[model samples]
Target chain A: MGSVFTPRNLLVAGGFILIALGIWSGEAGIVFEKAIRVCLECIGLG
Target chain B: MTRTPKIINRLIIQVAALFAYNPFLHNFLTGELYRGGSKYLCTPGLNCYSCPAAAASCPVGSLQAVLSGRNTITSTYVVGFLLLYGALFGRFICGYLCPFGLYQEALYRIPGRKLIPSRKVQMLGLLRYPIFFLLVVGAPLLVVDTFGNGTAGFCAWICPAGTLEAGIPLMLTQQSLRSLAGILFQWKLFVLILLSALSVVLYRPFCRFLCPLGLIYGWFNRISLHQIKIDSSRCTTCGACVSSCKLQISIHTNPGSSECIRCGDCARACPHGAISIGFDIPTSQARTVTRN
Candidate 1:
């Protein structure tokens, strides 16, 4: 079995940390704000 | 005749795509777009945030939005979500969850002469990296409006998935949107139509050539926890798997190639049962097996 501290595993752990930080820092809320409103430019209407 | 394992997998994945978009059942009945808190989360596939039934944000769209926004705070939410998915499943999401990918497969199933991509066509898969770099990241970061806000270049200019999933539905349902339709909408519609028609003959043309998300996830396929493994001890170089692969990959040599979506078609096609899809095995084992 591969060690738990393998580089890949570490990267995965880092990914989780990043996600947590993003949420805690309200970055997720920013994404939600953008996502809730339909950006007409995104669908190419503008 | 019984359905093949590949068919079963596709069916399960199609249902997953449906559930991913319609997580909030109420949105289906109301036909009103979900604007709930769950929209903050990003799905593992190419679902459009603008999709009326979508319960989550699109990672690609969110990444572009963040890059374009003038906000000094650089959030890693999109990157983290994408990295997490890529590191775990890689292109498996493309094969098993993306609604657009399922759409392409459904179109290919139609009664028509399927276009077998040539070696040159397969090489075109490399083009997606540049697209990811330029359209998804670079353009959004570099090109700014008069107010210094960047544009969501890929979503605004290139994403056919967004056009199909969001634009058409919104247009059909909202009378007010009809008056706002202009040249940009027409251009997107034209692109969507062209891609839809192309999908009937080509196997996942967008995934193969255009999807930036695919390009990003594919980079991790070689190291992803869930991956396709080839056991050379049971293998014959019969070339059966290659013919079976829609992505035109050589399974024995490069099972984890970025173009591979982990659809398991190659594994199912292998008469020798040499190819296996599983979790928690390092790709080094596959290399060792092939060398022996």
Candidate 2:
């Protein structure tokens, strides 16, 4: 359907593409690494 | 005499929030915080990672940390998770899941002169977008130290939720942290106190005016798989839904508004039962089907 290609659909497609790219690049490990430490600055102590 | 569905939903989410932070029960009993491996996965709602009882990472904080890291190329995980959430549930997490949202709603239940948001207050809601762009995304990408590391601008400067949920509790629990308290800590504490007081009078002031995570999810509300829908054939624009909506959405005119958290309050309040929530096909496709 012609209406299926609306801007909202495009945005959702873009989101899916970004997710694929993230998995391809191995960013999960980086997220895991950052999660382990309590960043003092995050809670404003630093 | 009977409890409303909204009250039941609120109680269910309150229990969920309690369970989300329940991993460190033993730590609380022994006067210690759990620092564990489970913190790696981001929770669906805005629970602060720094909370002593938190077992999962915060998506917004993780996004900032990844973007501000020396190598920015590896932020796919955080972005992917955020995108997945946005596309699926939008602000449903904000209305029913976020710990801070529950806290604010609980404060609002206190007997007081409730301030219905004025036009000016509604206009202030637009500020969340720029806050998202500048502090959450822009500053992290643009401003970097000599080592090419960025700062979590929103977390470091403005997150009252973080200050309330994590900073205050941590300081009260850890004696060493109290000695290290400085002007920045005081500033954040002041913000926390002010927001807490305001939430008693106004509904979800932080979510309406300052939450970047809400802004991010709002962009997808119109297109998210799970959404609030209104059947026009069954509808009369009697203004009941508008009054029922805590977020001040005009559901008859724009059912899937960005401000709507898919909370189903409007549906519950509707006299004709015109509104519903479900994982339906996109609105445009549904419109095309109607036209044919």
Candidate 3:
């Protein structure tokens, strides 16, 4: 069996840390702000 | 005749994922995009955020928006979301979850002479890397307006999913928006139509040749928690898996190929039951499997 410290597990850990950082740093709110408004550009209007 | 277990399972997941991404059915009728809390969260698949019924944000759209924003603070949420998903499931998102992926498959299922792409044509798959870098990352970060904010160039200029899921629907419902259809809309419509036509003759032409999201997820196929294992002890190299795969990859030689969408087709096709898909510690024999 492979060790617990496999690259997959390490990357997974890194992902969680970044997610935590994003949530704490208000990045989720930024994403929410963009998502709530309908950008004409996104729909190919602009 | 009953559908194979892989097909049945994939269909179930894809359907469930579709509903999960766009649960607000009433919005479709109202011709208004969903503005719910779920919009804060990104869907694993390439569902459009502006899609009338979409309840969640699209990762690519979100990524571009974040990149183009004037704010100096780089957002980690989208990156983390993608990384976590990639590490956990890889291109399984493309095979079994993406609404756009499902759309391509449905298009392919239409009655027609399915065409296998030539190896030279298959080289088009390399376009996704440049697309991901230039359109998704570079353009949004580099090209800014007078206000110092850049545009989501990929969504604005390309992205047939947005055009199909949001543009056409919105235009149909809102009479005012119909007047806004110009060169860009025309170009997008043309792309959507052309791809739709190609999809009838070719299996998942978009997923195979385009789709930056698939490009991202594919990078993690070698190390994802979920894996496809070929048990050497039970194996006869009869080439069943490769023949069964629509992606046309040699699974026995390289089970962790980036081209593999993890649809579990190969596992079902293995007559000897040598192939399996799940989370497990790699054994001594399985370690010999090569990565692409």
Candidate 4:
């Protein structure tokens, strides 16, 4: 109950919101996947 | 951890997810709010792909294919989601979002041993690295066809999630797939059954050792914007928090260890109210430190 809206919560909540928005807007799993692709592209790992 | 809230939260999600057959709810907000294409949004701990309501993709399954990528970069999306989830949630995603984690908890309820501690347990934890590198990463490259679309290694060969979601459903619908099932399918089913059995005695065995997503998320626990704070002045060091930890942590010994999921159990456990969850880099706290 105490400090339920800490940064971690906000980040997670934001991540979930982005995901929902992506799907509802017809972009399935786009947020997480976009980040992954960007990272992999950066590292040349993908 | 008492696990009541965790269990109840999972139960509620399961009921809502299963409402696919609940025609009454289908006409209302629950159906529209909780149905297909969105599972890629919510990361249920269970890997319950069969559940009617799922938004986000199965991260592990995605990684397995991407790692064992054949044609296109399969893991690109999976890795992105994982990093975001990890950076955002730290390890709480395992507690609140993973469908597989929920399933493991349900299996663990009929417990006998409750926990088994060992060096082997620690050793087993290391296996994830190789699993992440090879199955999650390596095999896909080797096995993928000329076009390059790789098989979802862990899911195709070993993932419990596929069995829970795709495997069970495909068998139920297609008689031929049930007949087409062979040693590999049986092997995964066996693993699922064994993990389910182990859950009664062990807490989150998969999360501890096998899950690639858990591994990915755990890496960010230490540096995530939010952190579990241990006020040394208020702490008694009685180690009550350590004993209460189901994740095999000693909060007094290492309050900010990577194993922490930031579920706030230690905070809840401390009678002295020594623990609090906060963003480690608050502007005010940062400024104070800078001044000091």
The number of the candidate with the highest lDDT is: 3
Which segments of candidate 2 are over 4 A away from where they belong?
A1-26, B1-5, B29-35, B281-292
Q: For residues B48-133, write the lDDT of model 2, one tens digit per residue.
A: 77776778788888888878777683476677677777887788778877888888888998997998888887999889888878
Q: In model 1, which runs have C-alpha deviations exceeding 4 angstroms?
A: B1-6, B24-31, B281-292
Model 4 residue A23 CA deviation (Å) reads 13
lDDT of 3 at B168: 86
Candidate 3 residue lDDT tens string, B261-282: 9888888888898888866445
Candidate 1 lDDT by residue in tens digits, B1-292: 1112476866787777868675765553444678888988898888888888888898889888777777633558788888788888888888888888888888888887989887887788788877888878887788888887887778888899889878887787777887799999999888888888999999999998889999888888988887777878998899999988877788789978888887878888888888888565557566656887
Better of 1 and 3 by DockQ: 3
Candidate 1 clash pair list:
none
lDDT tens digits, residues B222-280, model 4?
Answer: 75765676778988888878877887688766755777766566776788878776555
Docking quality (DockQ) for each candidate: 0.71, 0.48, 0.75, 0.09
In CAPRI terms, model 4 is classed as incorrect
Task: Work out the TM-score per prediction.
Answer: 0.91, 0.87, 0.92, 0.71
Winner of 3 and 4 under DockQ: 3
Q: How does residue B80 of candidate 3 score in lDDT?
A: 91
Q: Model 2 compared with the native: what TM-score?
A: 0.87
Error of 2 at B13 (Å): 2.8
Candidate 1: global Cα-lDDT?
0.81
True interface contacts retained by model 2: 0.50
Sort every candidate by DockQ, greatest first.
3, 1, 2, 4
| Docking level for model 1 | medium
